[model samples]
Target: MLTMIVADDEPFIRKSLIHVFNWQEEFGIEIIGEASDGQEAYELCMERQPDILFTDIMMPMMGGLEVAEKLKAGNCRARIIIISGAQDFSYAQSALKMNAEGYILKPVKLPELREVFHEAVTRLRQEKDHQLNFEQLRKQVQSNMPLLREKFLQNWLAGLYRDEGELWDKIGYFQLPFKRGDVLTAGVLQLDDYQSAIDKFSEEYRQLLYFSIQNMITECLEKPPGGISFVASENEFIVIFCPDQAAAPGTGAISSLCEEIIGSIKKYLRLDASIGIGRACSSASELEDSYKEALAALVHTFYTGHGSILYIKDIQPGTAALQSTFFYKFQARLMNELKAGHTQQVLELLEKLFDRLAAPKLQIDYVQSICAEIIFTSARALYELDEDIEQVLEDRLTIMDTLYRQKNISGLKTCMLSLFYNLSTHVAGKNTSKNSKTINRIRAIVQEGYARELSIARIAEEVFLTPNYISLIFKKETGETLTDYITKIRIGKAKELLHTTDLKIMEISERVGYENPHYFSTVFKKNVGVHPLKYRSGK
Candidate 1:
């Protein structure tokens, strides 16, 4: 319902205006208040914020034009209709300049008053609808804001956006906390043994558990100067901290915040987490560097163990000297242990290797590189044992995947030990009769025809064996699938070409039996840590 206020200095004029029409019945507007002077009318407008105001041009204390000017200056949204005489018609024109709705001259005609009031009502209804629509749109955008921000941040960090102007425009549109030059520190919080922690719960409860952990982190970070935290991946949460200028916290304070988050998660969620805080960068554009630093620090959790805070500043530089000699010796010993089918010896060697790599002097990348070397060495040993490395590790819970997932040295040790145990058992059970000959034949076929579209059935036809029997015996003796062995051979060939030849990546892909260069690059990156070009560049 529309509400209105009436004002004029003449008491009879005011009374007559009110009595001239049954406002509610004729115009669907109610006279909420009556004022004898413009001053009273302005005060009523200020108090009630009515939809419409009807006032005279000439009045004592304050005139209708002054009221209109004051309301306009104050940015009042009310519709104003002027009541004026011939002499006051010019004043009414001034009110119209102030955006008054309409003018009803002295001896106000009822029909003109009703018509003006109807127009005001129509406008008000239109504005109400527009406002409602605007509000709904605002709410919808707000609801999807988190997802949108995550996508933006993910792309921004991936270097997908290069335009600074567009970046700032998005930042403002999203109302992100930090401005262009504000310093931001990237921090990552990873739930220790995330899969094991939430495995027992249903999907709904698992989400609840994640939400609880998020809330705990938010609460801890928001203590005076807060930061923005979002789930960067399934097991990791990314936090961007732009310290409050008035109460800028030190690195120690950030450490304390991480400690608080850890403690809170333990208390509330009964879960352990490791937080890695990156060194501060001067702007959002440099967030990717900070994010990489934070991730590097987080990787240290495998060495340092979970339930601890790691700052990038505390990580030491790795020596290439140690990686060359020490890691090589370690890998050789580990491979020897695995080849001998000594499960306990292999486990013990893994422990020692981890302990050596866990030294505070080693860089996170150095540690990761050592771990990758261990995996490659194990793969080579399995190959030597006539074992299929791919089938053994094809559970998707590969050493590299575990290296990313495991939270501590113990977790890493468990995963490696499990793989070694499986390898030992498979080796111990290998038959040296027809199965070995069949597996050798399969491996030969893969080694020779890896660059072709080789399938188990095709190889079976060439070897005069059933596809099913070939598959069974091959897995039993080799510990890997035929497809995986072929991939390993093709990837090895691709790598050799990448390093030894000047062939374009497309030619290399064709040579490796991959028709698509993009697919070839993806497989190359998954198997080898870098893209084909980067690997070729020796990065």
Candidate 2:
């Protein structure tokens, strides 16, 4: 059962909440405690150690935001959610900095409460699972050599199965050869024109493309003579072929078989895929080398363009020189951007620059250098800030570099964005830069007007700036015009209300910054190409 604590200043409000929720019947939630103010809530939370905390923004002794900040500073495990009657989202934004789990406004509906409760429980479950996984893997590393243990832990965290016994069990039925004269051949499949495909993709379509790729990989290895594993989290597949040897004719036979597999994969998957083969290494213990070579072969996917089978020998190394301070220097630049609250610019620059590494002719060692540079940059930034991500990034990129060795454009995109998201979060948490504080204050005012009365004059007055100057600065920093962005935000809110609530059209209009229902309808149709009613109906 999950334990919950609810905090509010008003007795009537507290009573209403206790009545609204059936702690025992509706959910497996137990009302462990209640408090009349933020200070009391904090005390109760420390004493009771509830799984979730529902806190109001305003209180007499301390505000909920302060309580949340204190809890996060102490590394409290309880998930927090802010409840407030005010439409001023700046408080909620502050709560977000403290890692508050969710924000809900006044006039809280029962369904909304339930949704928040569900989210809190889900987060709790995730944290528990992660802790358990970490503990299990941590114990396994203690007895091994320090360097090997570090490498093994890093691999496991990157979704690579480090337990040879566990990995072999999965392929036990296939019974791959354990002896010498057997061969090992791996194929690298790259999504050839994924950039073009992504340009035409919606979020749902992009997910479909990934799932399709996963299915295609699975299809290719179903009954192969080798033992294959698709580590999708790492975006790479591994096939350990065991048959004949180099002293024999196994390498040639295995290469030919890989070509045949490529043809069959093309006939089916249909999304412009290509394959590359790594040189066959001597022993299973040398799987890492063969894996690297196989991935190096995938780099051919970019040059061969779309759907060509590239053997490892076809491409050669382009350069021997490496940038001495690539990772640390680049992260220094990125950290500066993020610290300045230039999140959008930071995102754009990382994406743009990292894509330059997607070349057709890089050798295995050069490819490793490219991946090392990016991972090193990320790791250096996190480590300098005292984060606990030592070796995690290096291991993940080690796997990702293999998947992208062929310069698989689509695969490269997946890896970069994932890295960027991680990079942004790390910076945001440690940002000591005070520069964006005032701008964020102003931006908060702008965000609150979507479903209510607002104007440049009103917002500027609150921020103590003239309307024209405010608009100019906002555009200079955020890249969107004030009026245009307000319209966009209001329309987005209107759509959300239309889908999530039973509020009538006029009410929805009034809620999202429009005084006149007719004007709201007009803008809705103009922006969404449909009347509000039609949108709600579709949902």
Candidate 3:
């Protein structure tokens, strides 16, 4: 299919080049037409789009070099092959500059033709590959549209783009479908004890968090909240409604909705979640204003304090209440303390942040982020030291990300207490200067039979402490209530047996402290999605 045209001022030379190739045997070149001059060759080249072109250097009316240059300048899509007599050396440089793939001597040989033919095929393959890469990049950008779009917009705002025109081009390329004057409303979510939860649970638990957030947000949002299309990013969702639309998430209604969301998520998911609603904007271009306001309100929970819904309306924009700079400052001070091996100072800062988050109105979702930030930042500092703490930090990140899924603060807090206690005693113990013998003994007892038939009453007796005191210290040190901690450990053990052993559900249930398989199934389904049997079956 390598169709081609031959061009030369002298008709004989043009025919001779055409006849040089055997048409099928040597090069499989089809001489679609012959041109006697550059003008005719240029016309023919444009019309046919031959796979290759062969032209002569010395021509009367129009030279082969001019024809090739004109085609290249016009952006014609043909690979050119120049045919020159042996002494026409001057034309070689011009042909090369014109981007001719090759130049052949007159009285062309068959071996040379074959080499040129293969060369042309190689060039064509390169072009094909370039096209494919562009196509794939386009597809990938589309698939990760929300995340990529957000990142791109952040960059555009942060001076990553050269100009507004460049920004406009990217917006078009991403197909955001936003124009000026379009309205957008957004939602903010925060994980209450995210850091401690992560350190406490593995990634399997984090996936639950993603589900938790989705379920809580989906209640009234299922119907689009009227004017906007829903767009979800990592921990946030923006419902892009219309400026002139029939309805909006009424300022008061949305705030109340956030409160209801907190209650529902807590009831079903066991997560402590705090949400903030931002004012609606008249244009997509003005979304940055709404987004900034929402974020300010979210952070406001820290100083105005946390644990409940904070609406932009309830709180004044500027300085009505003095901002407590503690949380903001703790990150740096804690990291600095951890670095100097100042264990006492580090623990004090950690507790301070923890206490601030525990304020009566603190939402579990936001608190988790605070905890996650505290943990992740600490772990990251450890990472900087080249410490092998990836497994720990990654789990905490997942925990932070998944705080939305916990059905109750009680469960989340229990999980937090266990993990934080272990982290303090075992992981970061070297940094601590003082330790109590009772806490040391309690830690030892929990470790010994955490996966067995453990209970607050049983463990308290085993550790020579009253059950009530045991529960209090456990919650204070680790953040989890004793019962939930024991159940999570037991269920975790059951999960391992289900995956690695041939034990039946009843057998696994008995093995993990549950006497009745039916109760075990109920608990398992509540914690994990499928029934115990289905889990064992790998379904």
- The candidate that wins on TM-score is 1
TM-score of each: 0.58, 0.28, 0.40
Tell me which of candidates 1 and 3 scores higher on lDDT: 1
Please give the distance, in angstroms, between residue 496's alpha carbon in candidate 3 and its true position after superposition. 84
Better of 1 and 2 by lDDT: 1
Candidate 1 clash pair list:
388-478, 391-480
- Overlapping backbone residue pairs in candidate 2 total 9
Decreasing TM-score order of the candidates? 1, 3, 2
Whole-model Cα lDDT of every candidate shown, in order: 0.77, 0.65, 0.64
Report the backbone clash tally of model 3: 41
lDDT string, candidate 3, 1-539, tens digits: 56778778777766766676577665556788888878888999998888777777767667888888888888788788887885656678888888888888867787886798678766766786897898999888778997777677665433456554555568677676555545555556665655653567667766676666665566655442333223244445443333332233334445555666677767776766666556676544455555566666675554443346655655554312213586667666665555434445556665565555544545445665555556666676666643655544447546665554444444445555544444444334533322245456666766677646666788778767567655655654567777777677678888899889888888888888788899999998888888977887873
Quote the positional error of residue 426 for candidate 1 in Å.
7.4
Which wins on lDDT, candidate 2 or candidate 3? Answer: 2
User: Which candidate should be chosen as best, given lDDT against the real structure?
Assistant: 1
RMSD of each: 21.3, 43.6, 26.4
Candidate 2, after superposition: displacement of residue 347 in Å? Answer: 34
Candidate 1 residue-wise lDDT, 352-371, digit = tens: 77677566446655555566
Give the runs in model 1 whose Cα sits over 4 Å from its true position.
7-22, 32-50, 70-78, 87-89, 105-117, 131-183, 222-234, 240-251, 267-270, 284-288, 316-539
Segments in model 3 whose C-alpha atoms lie over 4 Å from true places: 23-29, 86-88, 129-172, 177-230, 233-236, 240-539
